[model samples]
Target chain A: MTAPEVVSEDPEDTPAVLADEVEHVRKTRPRTNEDDMTLVGSVLGGLATTWLLYERVLPFSGALGFFVSWYLVFLAFYAGLTAVNRPRAVVVDRVMTSLVIAAPSVVGLALASTVVVTLSHGLPALLHVNFYTHDMSGVRPSDPYTTGGALAALVGTLIEVSIAVAIALPLGVITAIYMSEVGGRGARLVRTIIESMTALPSIVAGLFIYSVFIAHFHMPRCGFAAALALAVMGLPIMARASDVVLRVIPGGLREASYALGAGKFQTVWHVVLPTARPGLATALILGIARMVGETSPLLLTSGASSFLNWNPLHNPMNSLPLYIFNAVKSGVPRNEVRGYAAAVVLLLIVLALFLLARLVARGRNRG
Target chain B: MAGSSSLPTRTSLRVVDEVEDVPRRVVARQSTQDLAFTHGVRSVGFLTLVIVSSIGIFLGVQAKPTLQHYGWSFFTEYRWLPNLDTIGIAAAFVGTVEVAIVALAIAFPLSLLSALFVSDWAPAWMRPLLIRLIDLMAAVPGIVFGLWVLLFIQPQATHVAHWLSEYFGWIPLFKVHTDVHYPIWDQAPGFASYEGSAFIAGIAVSMMIFPMATSVMREVFSEAPAGEKEAALALGATRWAMVRTVVLPFGRSGIVGGTMLALGRALGETISVLLIISEAFKIKWNILESGTATISEVIASKYNEATPAQLSALLTAGFVLFLMTLAVNTVAASIVARSRSGAGTEL
Candidate 1:
């Protein structure tokens, strides 16, 4: 076909020729130097402002200063770009409009949370060392001695949590192993039920334990009951964790054991269980961590005692969580101090568990 | 045919000769015994189920008396006075529901947004950091959160209430009496005090619930099919529009599951609510003015001091709470099952 005939039919030739003419005209457009500089300036300005806001050399309120400075810099950048390159104004305006619309909600939440945290915790955390060591005992409401250390409560918490961990770990691990390795249809059903039990509230666990041990069994109000309650609370978590670990073990190992003339029990004990040992440990630790800081179950099952009791069965044991609870509930100033110290301790314990879990997981991954 | 028959006869003769060898029969019997021993290992798995069920049975037996006495009226009655033998769980039920609903209302949206920011909108380097921050928040025990709120948040709440009355007294919720010496007062005109009120409890509960909901939602959001999001974006949709259309639809069931999980956590929370609120069994409608009791808090405060009848009543309440949680979990599991089935078909 001839070039003109290929380009257009007799009816379509006019529009095609006009579109090519318009394209040729547009290609001759020029760029301005000021537009380039404006782009560079905006980029630099955003970076500089972000750096200053984050670096914290100046005594500016962290959240408020960062937000205000970011917006102002962004606004200036958009304005500069618009002034230099009018055609790009639409893009800049759209971006700026959305940011403006969204900024308040984000900034407002950040600011409110920061202010709350500072006012509530920051100042009191700076006050007396008495909050750390003393109990509410002997502290008079009118006297400066109204605040005492949380020593007794801390001891109580340690004993209660320790007892809880002792009960939860073995039960959780064995149950998990059963579900994954030896469980048949009935076993699977049991696992499903246990998984469902994960949704049981802490209080229900407490009430259940209380009714069974304290009311019906006539068990004394002590750390042992609290431990039982927490163990029940931690069971699902431990079972789930152990089950996941067991399932992840390769089937080839089990088959190899059978080929070597090992029995099912022997294979599971020596091969499957060993391979998942790290995860099992992690599960146990997690269970301990979960029950250690639980307050509700402990509150109902383990009556609060002001004095430290090492024996789980003899007397009411104070746990860190219970200590904090009792102190704060009393609405005494000294108790508030003890409460904060206990809180700090409890936080540290949780943090330690988390770190330990991460470490074990990493070791397993590497191994 | 004759040759094949002779071969079969020869093979049988060889097997019979081998069986006749000394120790062959003994080995076969030993193998049978070993198989039985292996089977015994499998039988022990039932012990876990036994332990779990035993707990349930024990609880049921203990709570029998109260359940028998109240029949169904226990749930509907609003009064809870153990000394007067007029105890009912109505006020505790209301407090539990009110606190849970209000906390969820506040935490749900913020958590969704925070999850979105971390999983989708955050810069690459910031994602891990934000995730760790969230994990840290979750790691903090409920007891610590309660202590922080009581010692720190209470004073600020008082000041805020005072400021609100001074500036925004026209608003009903913020009204405060200038003549009152306490920063927060129960009898402030048109305004309720923060002391032992549902509002404080709700905020504390919200703080406790936020980390759980956020972490779950983040995981769910990040797991959403990439193609779905890309397809929405390809249709000239904005980031928010894409999320609204593709991400949210896929995550709806997950969000529901997560919320139910969080509801379980909130329902069981004892120390925080107990420390922050008055253990009063009054069914007050005002969030600010009323001191309300929750099931967990009531049990915690009264379990030691309760008479036999009171203990039975508490056990009944405990049983009800247990059933409520089980019902919630069943619904959640069904929703999850449906979503999985739906995904299977799509695949």
Candidate 2:
């Protein structure tokens, strides 16, 4: 494996069999058989030379600088070495391959840095047990990490998001059923509308609710209103995803039930819906994931409050997203840490929801 | 599962007797079922329609005052100063388009290349993992990305922005006289208050929108007809050549649709843009300089503590943002629909 293999195609290129796997229509992926030691050796050499040369002229320091520069230097060194023996096409292919890989590597770096930074910055507050139990009441942002917790924001978020789910889940599932099962003349239009609704921005959703319920109707800035705003944003997502899940249900299942002398209604109720239940559950999780971290919508609909408010109907309620949104803007280190802690909590919840979605989806063995 | 025995042609019996024999007895039962299901579903279905309609009408009604006040100037004028009862969304509209264009420019090509690799070029073991990575990018909350940009990217981005302004200043878009505020470890104070510039926001948004573009293009490329790919390869085409001839042209509509979809998202993006850009009322040509305010950003930043007139103005801005996204989405939807047809019903 020291030398690169330039074979265009071989029997080894056979596409792996996976359920519902598309793509890989062409059973040809160029093999890169370069020696691991040489690759790592070149990268190390590139790093040494780049550090020496760039230390004087380049304005980068520490690991970040090394990490960023290694890619550029390593690519040049690796490709330049490869071009010494390989044809121009092989060199070009290898370079392009590295560049493509780099795109995602950079994105992965950003995502990882986000999580790590959030976790590390929030760790101080998280070490305290009361962080989850206590509210922000009587807690100063400048006070020690032992003082305040995200309890109020946590409860506020739970209430708002749950209420939103309470409203959106049933309606969204019903709409999805309508689209997939009872589709008719307005089905196309409803579908288009739902698709567009999926594009509806959080701020816009907030503005819609703010104007209609708050300004026009004089509704208070309560968690329920915030929930309504979230519902508006979450419904189309749930409906759209559920419709997709429902559509993927085999038509033959319906036919089988019909063959059993079951009407369309019975077939849909007993066969289609039941069979697609897992998928629908995934859709529901995804919809909740979509709305749970929403900030702009809650900011407008639910006025921020520092105290833990029990009633969501008549008074201001603070959500975690909005709390973070407010806290981060203060530009204080402690406030920033608090925001980061809240963010980590929200991120963990969304991660759990997505995992649940994937977990629930595992039972469905699509043919 | 659509078992083979259930196939109509495979059936020994026409099954008409099996179906018809029970219908007479089951009609009563099924009619009630049908009525209940249809009635239940239709009412909920109609509610969806109402929700959609109401979102539009409610926003429109709220925007009426602003629209009446501004008339055509609402869209035409560029200056936005609401407290003094003088405002128009011209600057915000241009800023939104500018930022979105810059974002698309960066993200579009990268997403296409990534999608190509994930769908056709990557090793079998890597493809699913990379595809899942793209999905993960899409699943992450926008606020997390915003915070990342704020905490990490902005301080580092100033160097790049400074380098561009220093070297590529000959270009109009790059011509800016902004100071580079390096991290305090290297220098004194880091942020010069303009760290969250338009270009930074654009790049941050590119990260956010990249997943969407990749997903669409991956789906399109994956749907390329297997027969055509085999033919292209059979004709002695290289992998790249085969992709160009077989996959790319097939996925062209999908690419356009994906780009347009990403563009729409970038336009209406609030949290990230709000976090990254310093609010400004007027449009500027230099992307590197800070003070970029998009329509959605304007609403998010200004909705609180806004006077009635200001609130109305922000609503008008939100409405405009809505319509713009709607137009983009409709186009994307149509393009995707057309691409599905062009894929020739393999779905």
Query: How displaced is residue B203 in candidate 1, in Å?
Result: 1.4
Q: In model 1, state the lDDT of residue A233.
A: 85
By lDDT, who's the top model here? 2
Tens digits of per-residue lDDT for model 2, A63-89: 555666878899988788877777776
TM-score of 2: 0.86
Query: Looking at the true structure's interface, with contacts defined as alpha carbon pairs within 8 Å between chains A and B, what fraction does model 2 recover?
Result: 0.42
How many angstroms is residue A106 displaced in model 1 relative to the true structure, after the best TM-score fit? 7.5
Local distance difference test, candidate 2:
0.80
In order, candidate lDDTs are: 0.68, 0.80
Cα lDDT tens digits for candidate 2, B229-282: 999889866677778788999999999999999988898888888888888777
Local accuracy of candidate 1 as per-residue lDDT tens digits, B280-303: 777665555447888878887888
Best by DockQ: 2
Q: How many clashes would you count in candidate 2? A: 0
Q: Give interface RMSD, every candidate, in order.
A: 9.2, 3.8
Worst 10 residues of 2 chain A by lDDT: A14-23
